[model samples]
Every structure is written in structure tokens, then in C-alpha cells.
Target: MSSPTRVYVSRLAGLPVYAPNGDQVGKVRDVVAMLRQGTQPPRVLGLVVEAFARRRIFVPMTRVTSVDIGHVITTGLVNVRRFEQRTTEVLVLAEMLDRTVTVVDSETTAVVFDMAMEQWRTRDWVLSKVAVREGAKRFRRRGQSHVLDWAEVSGFAQVEEGQGATHILAAFESMRPADLAAVLHDLSSKRRNEIAAALNDERLADVLEELPEDDQVEILAGLDTERAADVLEEMSPDDAADLIAELPTDTAERLLTLMEPDEAEDVRRLLTYEERTAGGLMTSEPVILPADATVADALANVRNAELSPALAAMIYVVRPPLETPTGRFIGAGHIQRLLREPPSELVSAVLDTDLDGLRPDDSLQAVAKYLATYNLVSAPVLDDEGRLIGAVTVDDVLDHLLPEDWREPDKPEEDHHAS
Candidate 1:
């Protein structure tokens, strides 16, 4: 019975749950605990296990024989019903992780990344340590993690009652990511990190892209390395590169290592370009199709939900040998023009071949002027051989033209007083 004295909920999740006869049962999906009368550690209730066909079942801790890194042993009998959360229960992974609460001893706030439960006696458990991280807006990841005793925590009552991060974020679901980012900017750093952690990778990436560089770095630091990498993958390559470039060299390399090779390669290529150049402002993934593609094909590509409005606004038509560095850039096709043409008409028919594109090394000022002169929201960026490498959108160009801290809220004017 030499089970671990304490365990992190994340480590417990996915561990095999076995029956008394050593027959493998379901896997741990989440840990369940109930709020207590006071600050005393909440009681460990059981494990929410996912059995065959992804069916979730409740295995009370009363039946759990032992819990180790790889396995959770339980009494042979399991409640084979759909697992549901009781009003008094809290699902650690779903309800508590990444929450911001005050550390009593420190009198400052910290985010909960993991919770530790200690075995008080045989089959008896209590919430014990919390793996927390705390820092100001500018702090780095070098030395921010700390383990706070359960007694040192307060304000988690809101989390136990299910009125926490998830609830707060739901209110912003209707807002665009950029608008949400603006709202988050006005909140405290802890709140920003909490919401960022609660968001899905794609949504978080969109919001992060809309945030200031300093905020982006801070929020990314709050996430575990794996999660941060996943969020980076969801962002456009140019935006991802910009964030990574702002991070410390070591941190940047580590995150890049965690990203998928294909995604990492795209960001790396963008990173090689100067931030003020067209290459830096351009997104490699755009609505691109062969010159022979029909208006129907162009429309379908533009209609993809994944493409941002700017990216979907115009379609780049390429010559033969279609690839990343697409063969000789033939011309660009506007979405409006494509819609006006018959669905059977080839994209080449509506293509505007005379419009010149920016070279990778073109200056940001040149890019802005080109967009303005051409009345375009996005303009293509080409390589030496006139290959379409990417496209720069007006949003990207405006990001460069505005002050670095433009997303930051303006400070209130100081009150003038007679001396």
C-alpha cells in the first residue's frame, strides 16, 4: 500500500483503471472532489472513467484500491451509469485548473496549473498542494512556478460553485476575437491568463494574435509548453513568427521544437525575414488556386470557414507546378469579380494580370502605399523568379504602422493643478 503521498490531477488523468481481479477497466477522464464546510481540504470523491465506446462511468474513491502514475486500482464493481457532476462536486480538470485565486500567505494572486491531493489515511484523500505560477505582466518563465499548500489558497470557492473561468468566457462568445482581446487587455494579468488558458487553441490563437506583443508573451508563458505549441500552430505563420521572435531565443527554440515539423518550418521561414519587410507581414496560407480553376472552385475556396476575411478576399492564380513557392505568378482574381463571372468560367478569365505584387524585401511603407494605390485589402508577395510566396493584408500593414503598444489602453490624462 505504498501509494504516492500526493499526485497531480493531470498525471492521474488517462491512467488505466483496473478492477479487483486485475482486469483492465476504463481510463481516468477526470478526478472528482467535493467542496467541504470550511477551508479544510475538499474530500476526494472518485474518478470519472471512460469505458468502452467512450462511455463515462463513476468509480468512487471508496472503491479505489490504489493510485499510481500508470494505474488506478478499484474495487471490481463499477457504477456503470453515465457520470454526472453533483452540485457539491468539482471536476478538477474541467472546473479548477488554470483558475486565478488568491494565495493567502503571499497576499497575491496565482494561477492553478495543477492540484495535488494527499492520502490522509487508507482510502482517504484531501486536497493538499497546488502547483501555481505568479508574476507581473513582464515576468518570464525562468523561475515562476511554486507549490502552495492548500491552506494558503482562497477565493477558489467561486470555482467550486462552477462560476469561474468557463462561465466568464461564455459571455464573450459573441464577441470577435479582436474585441475579446481588447476587453481582456483591460483586465488584470491573472484574469487574462485565466481566460487564455480556458479558451480552445484556435480561439486562443485568434485572441493572442489580436493582443499586444507583451501580452502575447505573458499569456503564452502561462500555458504548458505543449499547449503553447498547439496554440502557435493555430495562428497564421507570420503572426506566430512575430510572437516567437519576441520571446527569448531559448524559449523560442523550445516552443518551435514542440510544434509539428510542417508548422514549425513555416514559422521558421517567416522568422528569417525582417519584421518590417513584406515577407514578415505576409501570410503564407492564402486562397490560392490554379489559373484554370473555375469560378466555382474559387468561390468554394473563399467560402472555407478557416480562411480569414482578408485572406479570402482575393484569390491568387498561379501558373503550372503549383506548390508553396508557386510557379510563375500569373495574376490575382478578386472574389467579387469571380462571383460576377459564370461558375463555369475559368479564374484566368477574371484575373487582373496587370497589377504588380510586392517583392519579399519590399519595405512596409511600400506595402502600405501599394495597398492604398491599388485599393486592395491584400496584395501578393512574390519571390525573385516571380513566384507567389505569400500575401500581405492591410491588417498586417496597419499593425506595423501603428505604435508597438497600440493595443494597450490609453492612460487617463493626469489632472492639472495650480502650483
Candidate 2:
């Protein structure tokens, strides 16, 4: 049979000291239980010592009733008072209606869970009652409340690693899944899905997109179509379309059917084109202006709508009846240069009637070349019928091509030589 579990405490039940290492050793007085920040259900372990002077002590492991780490906690009191209000003492959450108490479960001498300051604070602490739990409730509040059981807590509730892993499990066994997920970064496919599913939809969406491609597919596969659609809808249309484009046709169709009508249509349109083409890479969001508006009005629209700077180029002026998707867009113009012109000037007057066009069907390589050849800071993208779709910027174009490890060395020679 497996060996019985062993638990250790740094504070001794009867021994109490006022100073570290009991320099001003005192008897164990009343113990103080507090709910410190970052702790759940609060803890009761530190002690009040009344030797030469009264002080609080923390009970760190390895130095039971001893001043191991030189430190002491104390409330501002010149002299100890008879039954001083415990509230005035240095405590966070002291008296609680409900509390969990741990006993040795074996030796009567062992106090599994108690209230005592670290050794330094409890130095010369006053010892009494010797042993008493306010309530009989005690088992263990271990594991992340939101995520997996046996979760380790660190900076945040997440999977702890290296030396930290062992510490979190041994210390903060009772932690929230959210607190743990915040700290965990790299996780295996199974673990990632385990946690992603446990988190609320919003957090699940956030973490799911950050996961590796294979893991992304695996996790998404586990979620029902409706849930999958909701998450993909939150992601940028481009990223969403890319992921969906990679799925099997039936799977893609299933998810798309569950998506919002408008968003679904947008993704379906994006999916129509090859993944490497401009249409495939382009965002469906676009900025459209009427052919009659003045430069000032157009500027206000861009500013008010919060369109990004990269969209400043290729400001399209369409003929009247802009509400119609198939409405004709007259031409393109540089909004920056137009800003210098008189505000009264019609946008059509400043529009570049001679600007070249980029149809959504064009390949990404062609789009890259368009930006390079024209020295265009950004360019407008339109569908086959001339409906403005999105503006492709040099930055977005580069991001599509560049890898994060561009500066890192090449991979193994087998992969390099093949290139």
C-alpha cells in the first residue's frame, strides 16, 4: 500500500516566543488567524508572543517555534492590554464565521493549520489553550476552482514550472483556475484544451487563438459548432477566415452555418479565394465615402470611425447611392495630401482618377508587388463588382510574410537545403 501522507507545520502548538529565536522568549499567547492577500479561506498559523515584549510571529517551515527568518509583526501598542480588541491587532481577516481546521490526524502535538506569525513575529509569543480549532470543518481546499485539479498557483493562477511548480503545489493548493491560467503559457495540446474548456467563453477565445495551429484545431474540434462560431466571430475576420479555411470542407461549412449572417457571409467571401491571394489575406472591413463629400467631411468620418492610419491611403470616392454594396466607387486619393487642400474641395476633385486598381481576386504576391511598385503606403482593396472591402497596408503585408524568428538562425540543415 502507498505510504500515508505527511504534513508539516513551522509553528509549535504550545511554544510561543516574543522575539526571533526566542531572544525575548515569552509564553504562547492567543493565536491570530488572518486572510492575507492572495490567500483563500484565510489562514491561522502566526502567533502572538508575550516574552520581554509582545509581538506577532509568522510560522515559516523548518523553524517551528524558532526565530528562523529574522522578522517580527506587531501592532502599535506600548504595553499589552487585558483582552485588547483582536480587531486592533495586525490582522487581515481574523474572526470568521466559517473556517477550516487541520489537526495532526496522527500526533496530537502537530497543529496542521493554525494562526501564528512567522517565527520572528511570534518570538516570545504567549502560548495557551495550547490547541483549539474554532470549527471542526477541515479537509483541504486544494486545486484551481476554475481550471484543473492539482493546479499550481504562482504570479497568477496557472501551471507552475521549474522550482516554482513544487512550491505552489506545496503552498497555495487552494487557488482559482483563473489565477492559475494567467500564469501558464506553454501547455501541451491536451492540457491546453483542458484549461481552455474550463475557462469562460471570452477567456477561452483569447487563449485558444494564441495556441499552436495543431492545438487550435484540436481544441476547436472539441467545442460544438455554435461555441466555435462565437469564438471565431470575436477574432479578426482575417485570422478567423484563415483558421476556418484550413478545416475540412464539411467542418468549415458546419461552423460557418452557425456564425452570424453578416460575419458568416464575410468569411464565406474570404474563403472563396486561395489562402495566398490578396482576397484571402485582406480584411473585409472597408472605408467608403460618397463622391460628393468634401475633404473635411471625409477626414471627420475617418477620425470618428477610428479607421487605422494604414487606411489613410486609397480613400475611395464612390458615386452617389453609397448604401448599395454594388455602388460604383469613382477613384482613390491620398487623404494625407488632401488634408493640406482647402476643406471645401470636393473629395472627387482630389481623388486620383488614374490610381491603379486591386481586385480581391489578385494573388498576395501581386498585392505585395503593387505596394512595392507604386511605393504606395497603403492601397484600397475591392471585390469583383468594385465594392470596397479593405485597405492592405505595407505593415500587414509584411506581417503576412515575415516570421518572428527572422533574426534567429536557420533550422536543421535538412530543412534548409530543401529550400
Candidate 3:
């Protein structure tokens, strides 16, 4: 069956994208379009697909074979390179939704809510229709809604100052923090700041941790000092520390002072370590339980949704003071061993006490080798007094080991041909 010639872009968001052989590739996050001169409609370039590991990749329009209500099918060949927006390109859902434009006929201003792309020729798609609503006047419960030809709308070509991100946030409400960070990274600085400001503290913190340092610093700078401190409090202690280190010393101290005492202490402690050391990369808050904790208790601790898989993979056993810089470290218990043991069994019985713990001054290379040698996803770091201070996860190590620009999109390799 042939797919429809025209489809609303909003309906396409979140739809699963599949390969020709019926393999699911990813989900459609946004559509890429190139704006043309004057009133001509923008050419639909491709779809921004969130592939495995939350990597956003571009699926050129020519490679898409079908765009049905249930799913989008592709020609099986997908470029694995991360999608980096060109200056001439715009993301439809992210940049267009909720834009105020003048209705040519009425000369009245209306907010765009949705856009429709139509296939004008073989393999050629363009935005042809816009759905907008006029602002409701006093005494009116709702404003009038209209569907108009793309030509009837003005302001699509002009970048408006102080745009709101309500609709853009609504469209991507369900996206994970990492994916949302990518979306924000591709947007203009002003637009990105607007979206960041719209997000609640916790959501913004999660997204901030995933963004590059420059973006993180920029977004944090845009927020008021109090709000920035609150956002920092919501982030993982290690990540918050890393970000704070990037700011001017005075600015960093001010934010720390505004943060809750307990949270501020953790960040302060992390800042004392060298950047490429185990203490620098390890998270201050890992699942730490006393030796008396039962296997069931360990299981419960690892089940917390906020924990990354690597951190949850192992439970650190301590003598007392469950927080980081805890009392004498006893050992570590892998989640796998906990599951195999009787629920009533004490974690102490299954603890891997023989494993050596990392020190604050241990080099990143040393930490990586320790995990690789033991095939561990996470390992505990102990203080000079032999107390559990933190746990270094594999993900953190990889982040530092990769090139400084690892997060930024790279030029597609020769093998990943666009056609």
C-alpha cells in the first residue's frame, strides 16, 4: 500500500522508524528542513532519528521508503554519524512550532501549532501547510483555528526575538534527558536558553549533565544565581563539581554558597581532586549499605530508577556511615551474586573483599585498567584512611578517555554515503 502524500509532522514525532527488513532502527524525534529564499516553502531534508544509545542520526528523505501512521520505514542503510544541524537547516518541530506569524489575508498574528509536509514530486518533500490559532480576545474562551497554505504565513523566514519554547517542550516532553540535550545543543543560543529556563530545576539539571561543558556553562550562566545553585544541587555531585570547575572562581564560590550545605560539601570535596583522577570521575553517591544489609536490601537499593546501570551493577559494603567518605570499607557485592543468594543472607557473606579499591590520586589510566582487568562495571574508591569515598563507573571513565570533542558530531566517514 502507498503511504499518504501529505502528513502532519507532529503525528510523525515518536513514531518508530524501521529498516526495510523490519528491524527497528529508532524513533522519529524531529524533521530537518532547509529554508528557501522569500515565501517559497522549505525543502524537507530528513528525519532526526534517535538511534540506540540515544544517539541522534539523520535519515535523509531519499532513504525513507514509507511514512505511515504506525511507523516510518527506511532503505536499511543508515548513517551512524551524529546529526549536527547546518546553519542553513532548521528542525521543524523544535524551531517552527508555536512561532508567531502574520496571516497574510487577515494581517492578524497567529501562533503556529503544527505544520504539514507534502511530497510534491518523487523523493521531494516540502512543508506546504500550517495550522495556527489566533490569540483569544477578552470574553472569548478559545481563539479561532485555521489551516492555511504555507504561502499565507509570514515570519517563517524571519527569526523572532524572545520566542517561547512551550510548544517545543510539549513536542519533546517524553524524550530522555540525553536526547533532549542533543536537541538543545542544535538550537540557537537564545532559543536554547529559553527552553532551559522553561524546564523545571530537576529536568534542567539532568539535561545539563549530558550537555558539553560550554553549553553547560552558558545555560547555567543564563539562569539566576539562586536557580543555578538549585539546579546544581539536583545534579550528581561529581557532575555538578565538574561543571562548577569550569566557571570563574568567584562565580563557582557564589553558587556553592547558595547550594544546600550538604550538597555544597560534596561538590567542594570533589573539587579538591585532580581532574583526571579516580576521585574526579567517581560519583559521590553510590549504593552503600552496611555489612549487615541483607541480599533483599541490596536488591532494593539497586532498583532505584535514578541509578545508572553501571552504578546499580554493584553494591558497596561498608562498616558504618553509608554516605561517601563512609566508615571503613568492607567489600563490594555484585548484583548478580545478590540475586543468586538467599534473600535473607547477609551481603557480607557474598562480598568480594579481595578486590582492591581505588585511591583518590589514582590516575584515570590506572582506574580504567583496574575495571578492565576485573571485568567490573563499577569499583569503589577509598580514602587514605581506608574509607569508601566514591565509586568510579565505566561510563565516567569512557567520557574522560574519549577526545575532548567526543560529544560533538563528527564528519561522516567516507563509507557513510548520503545517497
Specify the highest-lDDT model's number. 3
lDDT of 1 by residue, 119-207 (tens): 88655887788887775545555328888887788877872322247544543456668766765665557656777887999999999
Poorly placed runs, candidate 2 (over 4 Å) = 1-185, 190-212, 294-297, 304-309, 312-314, 320-325, 341-345, 383-390, 403-419
Q: Candidate 1: deviation at residue 142, Å?
A: 39
Local lDDT at 326 for model 1: 85
Which of the two candidates, 1 or 3, achieves a greater lDDT against the reference? 3
Clashes of each: 0, 50, 0
Candidate achieving the largest TM-score: 3
Q: 407, model 2: CA deviation in Å? A: 12
| Candidate achieving higher TM-score, 1 or 2 | 1
How would you encode candidate 2's per-residue C-alpha lDDT over 1-419 as one tens digit per residue? 11111112222222434433325444433344433344232234344333332222233222232332333323222133212223323321122101222233422112112222322243322211112222223563333112111111112122232111222222223323322332232233444454455555655655554444555688789787888889888765666887887799999999998988888887887777776677777766655788778888877776743344676555667765553243676887787778888989888887887655687777778989998888886776766777666556776577567774332222222211111
The candidate with the higher TM-score, 2 or 3, is: 3
In model 2, the worst 10-residue window by lDDT is 144-153
Q: Write down the TM-score for model 2.
A: 0.49
Cα lDDT for residue 223, model 2?
80
List where candidate 3 sits over 4 angstroms from the true fold: 23-26, 36-40, 50-60, 76-88, 104-107, 121-124, 142-145, 412-418
In model 2, what is the error at residue 208, expressed in angstroms?
Answer: 6.3
lDDT of 2 at 407: 21
TM-score of 1: 0.61
